[model samples]
Target: MNAHEIVAAVSSRRASAVEIVRATLDRIAAAKALNAVVTVDSERSLSDAATIDRRLQLGESIPLAGVPVVIKDNIWVDGWRVTQGSRLFADFVAPCDAIAVERLKKAGAVVVGMGATSEFACKGVTTSLLFGSARHPLDPDLTPGGSSGGPATAVAADLVPLAIGTDAGGSSRRPPAHVGIVGFKPSYGAIPYGPGFAEPFFGISVIAPIARNVADAALAFEAMAGPDARDSDSALVESSDVDSSDLRVAFSPKLGLDTPVDPAISERLEVVVEHLAKTGLRSVRRDPVWPPGATEEALMPLQHGGLAELYGAAFQKDPEQFDPDVARQIERGLSLRGVDVIAALGASSAITTAFAEFFREFDLLLAPTVPCVAWPLAQLGPKVIGGKEVSPRVHAAFTPFVNHARLPAITIPCGCDGNGLPFGIQIIARRGRDRLLLRAATRIEDEIRALPH
Candidate 1:
């Protein structure tokens, strides 16, 4: 059941919130063998649920009254461990809740526990000193994908109907696509990260939802979105009804990026595009009008800047303690000069303008969420995909430009690769157009679900 349904059932006394929380705790236990949860605070979670029940018994109307939600370890949840998926901060419990989390709690959602994230969410793989590694629920040996891998994996494995994760890059979406679930990374700053950090990622980190399906994702986002006085970047978007008619979309097999996608996966995605074609929303096979060097511009520099900023202090404390790749990333990012930073901003702005114009002709842009099918867990950073050597960051480059543009984008479970790993197709829209994007995505989602496996 979705978060709403579960809460509805509980509120109506059909089932107890205690019962739902117990089932979720049990699911996490069964999934403990998969190593998906970094911390399972059953005692605290149940106590929170008991309070929620008390409110319901008093006849208070709460939005997420009985829903249990998991938060990524990087996000602050008062009194819960906020490890940021690193041993460095393993014992660090938050003293306050982030604004996004506070909003959810105010609306009556129960916080389950801190979900695992990559160390500071710097890398694509989810592992830290606090928790070993977050394994894919579908196949324990493979990655659930990262840095929100734990949130994605747990939701996919049904530990929770909803989870909140952060996406500076594609951490939230990539994991869900890999796990055959749903993820929504709203335009950057759609939800605030206040009560922690001076400014995260120069405004790249978005508090996003990893959900079982699109509606739950939307509901979670709705509860968490809106401007908080603490976060100046959060925009004011008035809620409006969503409709399906009169939409135009452009799709790229590969967005001119030299991706090493498996032919079988590509074929499966083509089938998905064809399924959407049946909906009569105009589909244009126009070439991508992305700015020159956009693919390259979005990749290395940001990765370097992000890593350098996230782990530079770690390198100072003990160089040998850091991952080699992470160490190199810090070195590269720290050395970036003013000109390159200026050029990156220019490049990002140009690409945003180009796509903004492109969207004037198309309501949405559709593309493969990632280039390749889910491969061996041991092979991510080393393997050759799309016939070119792919490092971990390049796999995430396509999704971050939207961060730069602050556009809303969602990853929908489109189909399965031949190996049966999930393939998600991304649906992107203009800034602050999250509700519309979700409505359009739901149309395709309904169709995708109807297809025989």
Candidate 2:
């Protein structure tokens, strides 16, 4: 059952929370080959569900009553083992729940397990020395994409109806695109971030929601979003309804970066756009005028530097404990001059300003979530896209900027590639315009579903 149905069933006393959790745990146990989950505290999860049943008996209303949810390994859940997909901290346990997890528990969502993540969530694919790799449910030989791969897999595979992950550079969005589910990255401060692991993408990363559909993602987001004294970035903002007829939307296939998109993905996006237009949601071809040095390479020093600052000493003490890819990033970070980091921060500011200006003329921007379909497991990224050789970060081209600008963005399945693998169309809105974005996404999702496959 979906989260909404589970809530209704549990809240109405038609079903008990323990029953739902047991069924979910059985599903998780049967899907171990996916490697999507790193740990499951079955005993504790059942106890929590029993408590929720008790609460329902007392007539307390719960928004997510008895709904099982998976948390990305990087996010804390008090007493749960959270390795962040690294061997160095393989024995580590969260001392407390993250602010978002705390809120989820308060809403009566049961924590089923810790979903896997790349080491420090520093890589794009979700494999680690600690937890191996997570496979796409549709094709076990292919990856679901990562950093948030485990959470995306958990939801896509039906291990859980809702899951939470972090999106620093499309960790949440890209994975869901690969797995054919909904992933939402609200404006940076929409959900409180920490009391967890040190973030390599501080200020840019935001806690995100993953689910089978947009409404559930919105429900999870609403429950976790609000002001907190611990997270100064957190603030409550009211979302207003936007008139579909008056919405100014822009279609930027390349997101102004001239990034290469696979022909199959491009074709699917064009069809989806055509269908939406017939439904009265039309968009003009417009791309933001990005400032010089606004590429991902220019803004990467922050990630490298953040990693170095957080784990440089430990890395020096035991280099073999880290993923080789992550080790290289830390090494480069150690070599960076202070001026390089300042320049990267300046470029991020420029990118943010560019998007803000672009929004003055357009209320929404549409693009492909990723350039290609899911690729073979154990690789960093596709070596070539659209018949051209590309960098490993090429699959990431369309997404990281949304993080840099702290905008609200979502990815929903639009169509499938020739390989029968799924990809998503991304919808982005101005910073703090989450409700507007979700409303538009729901309409687009409905239109896409109505299209004849």
Candidate 3:
């Protein structure tokens, strides 16, 4: 069941919270091969469900009353282990709740356990040196994508109806695309990260939602959105109702000419554009020029630089203990001087300005969430796409820049490749236009679902 149905059932006493929690636990245990859930506290989870049941019997309203939700291991929950899928901090237990976790609890959601993430959420694929790796639920040999791989795997496997994760780049968006679920990365700070980060990615990262459908994703997003005093980045922004019928969309198969995309994925995008044209879009046309230096190559300094700032010292002490890719990124980050970061920030401003101008003529921008389908589970990303050598950040090509621009973006399942792995189409809007982006996503989501699987 989806979160809404679970809530209704629990509230009406058709399904007690304890019973639902027990069933969910059973599912998680049975799906061991997926290795999606890294840590679980059954006793506490059951006790929390019972508390919700008692409150419900006494006549209380709980929006997510009996729903079982999994949290990405990186997100702190009071008294739970938050390893961030890293061996370095494996023994550390959170002393307090992240603002996102607190909001989920207040909405009556039960935290089942921590899902897997890449070490410190530093990579696109979910493999790590600590918690191991998360496999795609549908195909055990393939990956779920990361650093939110475990959350996407759990939801895809029906281990939970909803999940909470963090998206610095496509940590949330890309994995759901691989796992065939909904991943929504709300605008920067739309969901706060207060008391959780001694130093965050400033304007880049945000807590995100992963679910089975657009509406459930939206429901989870609304529940966690809004400002928190502890979060200096938080601010109130009213969500306006948006209708796709009134909006023109710019569609890009490859956001840049040099970007590599699989031919099959490109064909799927063609099918999507054809469907959107039939739908009531004001107009569907190819995207015009985006700002130069705004591509994936431009954002690496900030992403890697921020990682170095957060974990470089620790990595230097024990390079062997860290994930090789993460350690390499930190080394690269350490090499960049302050002037390099300043130059990247200037380019970020340029990219943001480019999008601002683009949106004046279009309400949404659509592109492939990833260039290819889920590759082998052991690899970080495809070494090559369309016969060209891909950069380590290439898999994150269409995604990380969105975070740099501080915009809201979502990836919805569109179609699957020949191997039955899912493909995702992304919809993006100007910063603070999250509601509008979601509205269009739900509309396109229907067309995507109706397409031949």
Candidate 4:
């Protein structure tokens, strides 16, 4: 069931919150082989659910009443181990709830467990030094995609209808694409990062929702979005009504670049694009390219730099304890000079301006969420896609730039590949146009249909 149904069911007393949570807990247990949930705080979660039942008995209003949610381990929840899937913090306990967790609690969502993530939520896949690889629910041998892989897999596998994850680059959106779910990264600062010990990736990482459907994502987004004094960047922009009929959408198969795209993915995306054109959109074929030398991989230094600043000493002293991939990134960050950092920032600014210019001609931008379907669990990404040797981060080409621009973006599963793996289609809108992106996604989802749960 989606969150709306859960709210209605619990609200109408058709099922108690405890009953719902118990069922969800059972589901999580049954799906334990997926290793999606690294920690299940059943005692606390049940207590919270029972409290909701009491509140419901009193006829109190709760918007997300009794909705079970899995929070990515990177997100703090008071008294829960808030490790970012790192060995250094494997036993660390959060002193207090991160603002996003507080908001979720206030909205009556029960967090049943902590989902696994890449070490420090840094990698694009879910294998971590602290917690081993999180398997895809559809295929245990394959990855769901990462940093947010645990949360995405939890939702995809029906362990929970909703989960909260973070997207530094494409962590939030990428996993959902591979797992056949909806991952939303609202405009940066739309969901405040507050009351947490540190801001990962220097605020490029935003706490976001991973849900089975768009409506649930929208509901969770609305519940958590808005102003919080703790985060000055957080705004109270009310969601505006958007009509898909009047919107201009640009659909690019490879974003106009000669980027490697698996033939199967291209074929599936074409069918979705055709369906989108019939949905009353003023659709055009246009590729929005980044300014020369601007690439999503450029954000790697920023990510590693932030990690190094926060955990550099630990990394240096205990390199063996860290995921080799994460350790390498931290070392790279430590090796960077102030000049290189400033140069990357300047390039990011230019990339943002280029996207702004592109958006002037289009209300919405569309592209494949990733170039290919989920690759093998043992590999980072496909070594070769569409006959081209690609970097490990090559699949991220379509995503991180949106984060660089602080724009709102969403990925909805469009279809599956011949091997039964899922692929997603991403939609991006101008900064602060999160609602418009959601509206457009809903219209497109209605036409193309989300992958079967």
Summed backbone clashes in each candidate are: 2, 0, 0, 0
How high is the lDDT of residue 268 in model 3? 90
Q: Which model, 1 or 4, shows the larger TM-score? A: 4
lDDT of 2: 0.92
User: What is the C-alpha local distance difference test score of each model?
Assistant: 0.77, 0.92, 0.85, 0.86
Q: Name the TM-score of candidate 1.
A: 0.94
lDDT of 1 by residue, 1-453 (tens): 898798689879897787888888888887787667778788988988888888889998878877888899888888888877666676888899999888888777888767777777777777665577788887877877688988888888888899998887788888888888889998877787678643236656788998988988988888888887887888766455755578878887775565677565577767777877875755777645777777654445666776677777877788766655456767888899867767777777877787688777877888888766555565444266667776665666557777767788999988786677787888888887788899888888898787765
Q: State TM-scores per candidate.
A: 0.94, 0.98, 0.96, 0.97
Candidate with best lDDT: 2
Tens digit per residue, CA lDDT, model 4, 1-453 = 888999999999998889999999999998888999999888999999999989988879999999999999988899998888877787899999888889889888999999999987888889986778999888898888888999999999988999999987889999999899999999988998857657547657788899999999999998899878988888755367655467878888887666889888888877777766665665788987677778665556777778789888987787898888888888988998888777788778887898899999998988989888787899987788887898888877778888888889999988887778888999999888899889888888887764332
Q: Name the candidate, 1 or 2, with the larger lDDT value.
A: 2
Query: What's the true lDDT of residue 27 in model 2?
Result: 96
Model 3, 135-214: lDDT tens digits are 99888988888899999999999999999888987899999998889999998878888566443354778889999999
Q: How accurate is candidate 1 locally (lDDT)?
A: 0.77
* Per-residue lDDT of model 2, residues 329-377, tens digit only: 9999999999999999999999999999999999999998999888889
The top-ranked prediction according to TM-score is 2
Judged by whole-model lDDT over C-alpha atoms, candidate 3 comes out at: 0.85
Q: After TM-score superposition, what is the CA distance of residue 147 in candidate 4 from its true location, in Å?
A: 1.0
Which residue segments of model 4 deviate by more than 4 Å?
A: 242-244, 450-453
Worst 10 residues of 3 by lDDT: 194-203
